[model samples]
Target chain A: MGVIIAKSLNEACVVLAENPATTVLAGGTDLMVQANRGMQSMDSVLDLSRILELKEWTLKDSEIVLGAGISYTDLAEPQIATVVPALAQAARTVGSPQIRNAGTLGGNLATASPAGDTIPVLVAMDAVLQLKSSSGNREVAITDFITGVKSNALQAGEIIQSITMPVFQGPQEFLKVGTRNAMVISVVSLALVTDYLGRKLRVGVGSVSPVPFRATEAEEFISQEFDWEKNSSLSEKVINKFSDMVADSTKPIDDHRGTADYRKHAVGILAKRALERVCANGES
Target chain B: MTSEIYTLTVNGNDYQILDGHPSESLLWVLRERLELSGSKNACEEGECGSCTVLLDGEIVCSCLVLAASAVGREIVTIEGLGSGNEISDVQQAFVDAGAVQCGFCTPGLLVAIDQLLNTNPDPDDLTVREAISGNLCRCTGYGRILEAVRIASNSRTVQNEEEKGK
Candidate 1:
């Protein structure tokens, strides 16, 4: 195998464009695991960690423009917590501080794992990703970008350059249940965002499906069926019905962490918890 | 593989390696090349905090750190703590509090606590637990480490007060 040392983003892009078969290495958190397990083989490798342009993060037009290479450590700052608590929450739950500092959002997007903790939060926010190649750049929504489990619409030679998400007015939260307290992968994860303006609700359930997905049916019921204009009180029957709907929407497969039924049940519990938190915050 | 010549200022000492591979981890380089055996290599997969080290004043798993990627940076291992040929205050506290069980997890725990107390001296119990949550210990159940951090903080505070009085 050969390695290409890229000192700049442009150089990395050019290298990726030239060697379509080369694997791009950002933080090496994900790639190292694959390589160690003999899950990947490549003719070339392009190291992108030294590219400073891809590591920046800023705000523009009330939207957060996050560089793809911004580590979870960078996003866990107090400023990000104030502006985008959901993202910050998700970032805080990611592995340990060491992994948080080394892992990049682009790597998560590239992996497209159903268990990717931050993707659901990004999806619930209607996040857009900027894809760049030697040719040019184009923006794509996160939902459309991820086609399936471990499958993505990213074309060859294109790298995720940046991601943008709107700053919404309502409350949002990201939750996950892992094996242990720290440095454990999710068993079942959830990202719940409320779009209060249009009376629209967004719910995303991860680790319970092929890819992180929205609970549209339950979302509809919570936003429309409930008579919130008169009273925000919800009965047990209603919550049970919503949980059943969430269970039916997911297509989880039994894996090492949990059974399909267990994951479905956990997702339902997480959805209910998320709804409770959102409603509890509504009063304050 | 193409390699880079890098100089790392580690624990007030400088190391110059000519063939540091970018993907090669710093833990092995520190142990094998430089012969600093303080950090353990248990669970090289980053799950166990046995390879914990201070990189540029932050606790990070040395197994996951690429040696060439840490150029022009500062690193502190377990050996760097305390005075010359003596343990630091925190290390002494750990021993006093019976925090060392099998001692395999001692180096990483010491490094983890060193970074934490150095940054946050008067951390509460919950804060200490959170700070060292990444470090795992098979024996002792972490009751001793908890007591150790608190005791170390209190002793340090008292020592400071005595100096001021004098």
Candidate 2:
């Protein structure tokens, strides 16, 4: 076994280009666990923690570009929380303080778990991922990046460089159901973002499908029904209908964590609560 | 297969890992190679914080950290908590509060509480609970552990005041 600690992004890319089979280690929260359990073999490893470029974040105008190595603890900081409250809320719910301090945004994106706490928030914000390799860089939407459970569209020698999301001035909420309040994987999660400038509401649902997806039908229904000018609330019937539509969009499965029926039901309830918290003014 | 030698800075001392495999975890290297058994190894995974150690001043599960990745980083295990032969204030508070039962989770809990107090000297109950949520104590049911944190915080406040008087 060999380990190469790359001090910069260029060095890391060169290493990856030379040997595409090298296992990239960032934070190592997920990969090391697999290695400990004999589930993953590391013939060669590329440690990315020393790369200074991946640890930085930039805010340009109305968009925020978070470096791939930004930890969940950093994401929940006041600097990012004010701009992306839902992402901060989701980051705060991931694992525990120890995990959050070590787990990076790029690690979460690379894991591509359907039950990942932060993915739904990223999807709702329509985040674009910057993938870089020795050859060049490419951008992919969050929806197109995650292909299935524990699967992603990352090619060999490619690394998630940064995640870019547009800042919006509206109420945002991230809600999830887990067995325990802390240190538990989400059973079902939902993120709701209100785009006041565009007069559109976005909804992202997770843990109930193969990939975290936007509840487009429910978003469309609520966006059409709710009055954006006055920022009025929706009736109880409308909320319920929107929740049902969100539930109908899922393709859940019965797993050790939860049953398909329970996941669908929980996701709908999460969607409903998220909408009420974000959009419900005083009516319902 | 060739074994590579790497130097790890633990508890202000540099130890050369001559027999460690590249895939070995930091927890394994700490306990097996360096003989720092104070950092308990309960769950090899990150779920149980029994193997918690401060890597570069941030508490993380040593089991989830690759030993090779931690070459140049500073690591503080439970053995490095106190100065000289004296147990730290938090460790003494745990003994005073009877927070140790079976004692598997004590080291991790102490490290977590130490970090919490370092950041926030006087944390509320919710803050304390959230701070130590990663550590799982099957014994004491967390009642004594929480009590230990309170005792540590109070003593630290008194100590701070005394230092200010000087």
Which candidate gets the maximum TM-score versus the true structure? 2
Clashes counted in candidate 2 amount to: 0
Stretches off by above 4 angstroms in model 1 are A1-7, A37-45, A226-231, B2-5, B18-22, B160-166
**Candidate 2: which docking quality band?**
medium
Kindly provide the TM-score obtained by chain B of candidate 2 when compared with the true chain B. 0.97
Scored by CA lDDT, what does every candidate get?
A: 0.81, 0.91
Model 1 C-alpha lDDT per residue in residues A1-284, reported as the tens digit of each score? 45565778788888888888887877767776665445655336787776787888888776988888888877888877877788888888888866786788888888899998889889888899999999999999999999998889888899889999987767788889887767978888888887665677688788888888888888898777654454365777877787788878899999999999898898888878877787777667
lDDT of 1 at A213: 82
C-alpha RMSD of each candidate structure in angstroms: 2.4, 1.5
- What candidate 2 gets wrong by more than 4 Å, as runs, is A280-284
Q: Judged by lDDT, which candidate is best? A: 2
